[model samples]
Target chain A: MATVAVENYLKHVLLLSEGGEELVSMGDLAGALAVVPGTATAMVKALADEGLLEHQPRLGVRLTTRGRRIALNVLRKHRLVETFLVETLKMDWSKVHAEAEQLEHAVSDEVLDRLDALLGHPRQDPHGDPIPNRAGKIDSQVYATLATCATGRRLRIVRVTEQSEEFLRFAEDSGLRPGAELSVGERNLVSGLVTLTRTDGGKIALGVAAAGKILVEPRG
Target chain B: MATVAVENYLKHVLLLSEGGEELVSMGDLAGALAVVPGTATAMVKALADEGLLEHQPRLGVRLTTRGRRIALNVLRKHRLVETFLVETLKMDWSKVHAEAEQLEHAVSDEVLDRLDALLGHPRQDPHGDPIPNRAGKIDSQVYATLATCATGRRLRIVRVTEQSEEFLRFAEDSGLRPGAELSVGERNLVSGLVTLTRTDGGKIALGVAAAGKILVEPRG
Candidate 1:
């Protein structure tokens, strides 16, 4: 059985590496796991020894095929659990991520499949993170963010890229969730602020870094 | 947060003691937890020190009021999860006990409350085991079992006392679940056999010990 630590390590690697192929720096991995750099290094070495990852000496690490398979499954469990918590339980969108973090490891494939069916096989979680399918495949398409999209043209939020719960609560309050229509009113990178104009004629200002986490697509 | 092992130990102690006030022998606790006697003793001592339980050296252990509160909460999560699996997810009743065992530890109180409401605040799980409420109170009403019910009396199965997966599967196939109507056709203690006659005119024989686990009530 994969221990929670092992599952978490692999999942973090899959998340850090785009398309599960790029090398993940030890510093970023340690930051993601909230572990000391040495601790992260030791775990990555052990995983590499187990053929779950390729630890490139001092360069970095990437998951092996088998490791990606396990990581994808854990991701599936996490996102589906989040979806269940929010959609079925009517829990707060900002709170479900933390709840799902603990439940992801405990949920079996059987329970996850049942939850997936119950949620009508959602493609994305409440935060708009794409759910990896059972075959370890994910939708990796990129979308423009508030920091990059054309200003004043109608754009719909596609994903919130859930980070801190505080950020999520703020996003929810601003009506910035996925499928909500908005356009950039102002993007002053040097000032590190962006003003979003909602379809409801509401305006909200966010830090440029925060604005970058909200993925969006232009409305035709 | 209570660790999974701590939750299991407390729950099992509550189960072995009919009213959660009786002394549960170390031998029974060990058997229920599948831990060696030494391990059970060591854990009991730790719990006693923490004021969760009272351990009688070389004899047994019993839950303190604080311990009972936690134990009841765990039981509530377990039975409610089992009910959701069966009544909502359409999972096989025989397999849900094991699934609930894992979920009970992972489910948060908030999520459980939502599930309880979603399940219509069910008083009992599909197995007919009473679910504890938010106040940590449980229904402990006693009911006669097939081994003790009057022969040829019309009876209704109220609970099956879920034990093993094999037994539950067998019970399901025998139409011996809760709410099923049946009658104790015969019970021969000397031969250690009990015959159950279903209302559909089907008959089945079980060991006296097995019959004792099937709680039933005389249908007036």
Candidate 2:
């Protein structure tokens, strides 16, 4: 069984890979995990020896099939726990992520299954991140972001990929959340800003970087 | 911020002390924690230096006020998580203890408070173990066990202090759980056996050691 540190490392690798074959750089992995580069390198070598991942000298690391399975399971526990905290416990959505970080390592598969059933098997958590299924399968559908989607087209928020509490609070204050209906009124690439108009006739301006974190799909 | 090992050591010390001022023996602590006496001694010294506990050389270790507070909080987390597992998740009572053992170390106070409210501020967990309050207050009432209680007097099982899965399963099979009403029909100290009769007319026999684990109070 993986230790909490091992689980965190594997989960971050999967998140940084973004459902692609791209190798996660050591610096990026260290940064995501809040560890020094040397520590990440040593741990990556150990994981490679354990056959959880493949490490290329001077390049980066990528998850093996086994590694991805463990990572997905951890991610599933995290997102489902976050959902339970928000929906069942009525905890603040912005705070659930931090709570879930600790719980994800401790929850057993049996408890996860029960939590899944109690939450009616939600597909997405409060942060709009996908919850992996019992078999560790995650939804990999692509959606355009507010920064890139066509202006004047009605869109529904599908995900808010950022998890920082401050960012989530700001987004919540602006009524930017999954299933909210809106359209991009204008995109000013020169000024790196995006203007959005909610269906309720409210306007909000976001920097292009922040806008890119909010995924959307055309309203069906 | 105790690590998992530190938390376990302190929690076990508290349990072995049995809500008394008596010092917990190093041998007993070692046995409970599954570590060698030397290891227990070394760790106890470290904890003492940290002001979590006091170790009397060659005698025993005792929790300081700070140590007791931490231990009680961990116990509260454990029992409350167990309650949530059984009540909300509908998990098998026989299995929740082991699950809660892992979760107790990970759940934050905020999450625990929410769970306490969700479970309607339960005072006792599924096994009739008293949960400590947020302020570390615990009910430490004393009760007699079937091995020592007056024979032929109606008694209700108040707690089953044993946590082994096999014992719990056997107790469940025999309906010897907390809140079960029964009377000791006979006790043969010479043979180290106790025979019990349930209020519903079922009979079961247990060895004195096993009987001692099931605490009972006067039936209402």
Candidate 3:
């Protein structure tokens, strides 16, 4: 029964705090939401009052268990919607995120379950992000950022950081979809650019920032 | 950029208007949204100010072309989500409507188109409600209420008017689905009950109210 804005805030806080034992800072939330610090403070206080979040002035923000559940539910809905949009609708990978972002908050548990079944219960979304199970458990897949892949190493794209649309479009055009294989050809230490040869025989250069956003697993 | 509540109003107006010939009353809107007449009036005025609707005093209200477009978009999103939830996630039919209702307002065109493609450009939802096309056009399929069907006529269930979970469960339990075949075995003039024989050789009795909600087509 959470409002859309409230759900969005919970999702952001959960994503920011993933795999970390730290509280998200007010400035961080503000920057993420692109809101003024004062606005973010007001919203955060509202969320805390709703029992979805905990706020400590100097310590930043952490989700209560209830908050985390809601966050995971939203994430599950988003990823499932993305997968449905791409696999069933044949939508361009670049276009599904925004649509899924809107849909993730609205679907019911019954719809979510049916979509999961229809997609054959995919472990990862189109972006290679894990889909949380019914019990809210995320699969712990070990992945390395493209920036850390050694030169000459063969790797398979596993996931990409959900950042800007531009980043997603670049990944799509460069054949960086999940399960695509690439061989690291060279690395520029100064610029953090990495040249890679894709399994489809395509070649591309990725800057450190871009490479860092791409998660990969070493290929045998 | 319409809010969920606003989108709901638009959709309700569009559906209630049914071919844009009649103006929808505030009483009708209130009944649809389960709100008070004053609340409906306030909302209708707000929508009028936004230019999504036209109010004709005692004649009630109607959608402007722009309003129709918005309603279609919301409908497209709703049907697509229902299709996705049922086809992909394996959700029960009864559970998808409420979820899709919320999602219809939030999903973008990109996601909607993708979902349409993923669902193989379905023309109808699970309940046999026609999905609007991309141009905001809905196919007008004629249906006869089961209560009015001639006795001894073979027919097929095409759609149901009630979207409630209890109603859906009852329909399902009675072997009534979109394509289920039935014969009007008997009709009681006094009690207004209809007895139907299912293709699977089962007999079920439907009250006049329930029969009125079911739309059926003659079997070829």
**Each model's TM-score?**
0.98, 0.98, 0.88
Greater lDDT among 2 and 3 belongs to 2
lDDT of 1: 0.92
On the 0 to 100 scale, the lDDT of residue A179 in model 1 is 89
In order, the Cα lDDT scores of the candidates are 0.92, 0.94, 0.84
DockQ of 1: 0.85
| True-vs-predicted CA distance for residue A89, candidate 2, Å | 0.7
Arrange candidates by lDDT, descending: 2, 1, 3
**Runs off by more than 4 Å, candidate 2:** none
DockQ of 2: 0.93
**Pairs in clash, predicted candidate 2:** none
Error of 1 at B133 (Å): 0.5
Q: What is the lDDT of residue B119 in candidate 3?
A: 74
List TM-scores of chain B, every candidate: 0.98, 0.98, 0.96
Q: Any runs in candidate 1 off by more than 4 Å, and if so which? A: none
Q: List the candidate 3 regions with Cα displacement exceeding 4 Å.
A: A139-144, A180-203, B87-90, B118-120, B198-202
Candidate 1, residues B1-220, lDDT tens digits: the string is: 7889999999999999986467999999999999999999999999999999999887789999999999999999999999999988999999998988999999999999999999999999999999999998789999999988889889999999965899999999999999999898888889999988898899999999899999999887
Q: Could you list the CA RMSD of all candidates, in the order they appear?
A: 1.1, 1.0, 3.0
Output candidate 1 Cα RMSD: 1.1
Q: Quote the TM-score that chain A achieves in each candidate.
A: 0.98, 0.98, 0.94
